[model samples]
Target: MAADRRVAEGLEHLKEAEKCMKTSFFKWKADYDGAASAYTKAGTCFKSAKSYDQARQAFLKAAECNVQNNVMFHAGKAYEQAGMMCKELNDLNRAAQLIEKAGHLYREHGVPDTAASTFDRVAKLLEPTNPQKAVDYYLIGSDITECEDRPRQAADFQKKAAKLLVRMGNYDRAVEVLKVEKKFQIEGENAPEVSRVTVELVLCHLARGDFVAADKAYKDAYGIPGFTESDHCRELAELLDAYDENDQDRLSSVAARPMFKFMDNDYAKLARGLQAPGGGEGGKKKKAALLDEGIEEGMEKGQLENQEVGGEDEDEFEGGLC
Candidate 1:
């Protein structure tokens, strides 16, 4: 109760502080960075005080000050934060403009991967403005670029674009990205898009509990085109099938080509179950096998000694986190 009352009092003080800052130099100061720093601190205080609008305004002020001070990165970050706030309020166009500004600044500073990712983010915000254009920008980052220049980063962007495209009824492009991701020769990207690129792969890793390998495979797959049946995708599919047999593994198997290969290992066994001639029923059996195996394993030790098995219920299964 005391804490809540104190918070209320602090919020009143924050409003006074906001009034002071607004009256004071929401005016240019000689040292823009210093002024921006003050505004950022003010924003933090306002945020703590539960004054979202004031915090948003302070962050915007800080961004403008950063631009004035020639600190593009900080400016970009500030706008990104403000854009997030605006997005939370469903003010999409303003959010998009702010995010676009950030992307433009990142591009001006020669940060292609960051710029590319920023563009991807901004495009998402502007989906209502033009959905195709967002997808086009994502494709530019993912495809139409070579391994010699930001290939891995571009591939990542492509993956993100492909996902959104899939939602947009661009399945052909989505499949094309998955099919081509394995051909790039580059290793890792210094910066990555915050969208679907890494997420698709992360979902794969979760199925197998192989995070290390997942990261490597995703990076390798990003920039390469001919690597459609890449080891990463096949292995991920196989892993997912291990838990739930209902999945499409043929494409991954075909894609994992000369470069990276997913052998006839554990995943392979599951893949066989998932890809057999019987199709859906085969998948169901595989899922049953996994569940039975889990139950047996639990009964093997004192693991389930303190627990009781529940009533018989209809078993269900599905696969492919990616």
Candidate 2:
């Protein structure tokens, strides 16, 4: 009964807010500030009465009024509140959308930190049920932080996106995200992180059966200070060599190393799944092709040598005619 009474009171406030929006001879303005305030009160009352849908609608109205009043920060806050109400109603999709709108509003209001945080919240909310959407929000968060000159924060968000992609079995996209993360780490003078990301890039390439790309990723790390001496470089070298030699046993052994086990869960799983290229029929065919080419080249070289020897003998027999 008390909740119903609150609902009735909320409706009265809503009516008053609508009336405030009207213009008369005495008032040229639409009284947007008063409407926003009244709508905010209505939303709170509805929320307290456990009418989440009604609360969400009221908060969204409040946000619109705030926007019309040019109070962007308050508008963002109102949208955030609406998103919370959506969450309470188990409308996760709508919650994410509202929160994302709030984030954009915060960004447009010139509040970089708040905007980035809002984006991060939306990403987290979407991570469990909609990983792709989460990745999109994470990227948006990273871009915002990057533009604000927050390299470390940007790199952190990119790392999250990369790891999520790996878990989703999207290694190619993961590699691209990791590359961006590596660039950020390098620019930040974070050598250890750069080496770590390079190692991840190598593993991701390997996961996709791209041994050449994996080797190139390893070699590219040589430019990072101390990477050549780092354990990551050594691990990558051993892994690449095992793939090149088509040593399945050695590849498995290297992949089973403690370092690989200690990586993020997705990457750790990826490492465990790393197979030597020689293990497949395609690898066998490639190896056989290379061997045949090598034999053919060797036979051709031998024929050339014999011709040269015969010419020299013929010249000897000519008794220095020239």
Q: Which regions of candidate 1 fall more than 4 Å away from where they truly are? A: 1-29, 116-137, 140-150, 171-322
Candidate 2 clashing pairs? none
Using TM-score as the measure, which candidate wins?
2
Query: Which candidate gets the maximum lDDT versus the true structure?
Result: 2
Question: Cα lDDT of all candidates, in order?
Answer: 0.56, 0.91
Candidate 2, 243: how far from true, in Å? 1.8
Taking the tens digit of each residue's C-alpha lDDT, what string does model 2 give over 1-322? 9999999999999998999999989988899999999999999999999999999999999999999999999999999999999999989999999999999999987998999999899889988899999999999999999999989899999999998999899999999999999889887889889988988999999999998888888898899888887788888888888778777767778989988889888888899888876463444566789999999999999999999999999988786765
User: Candidate 2 regions off by >4 Å?
Assistant: 1-16, 280-322
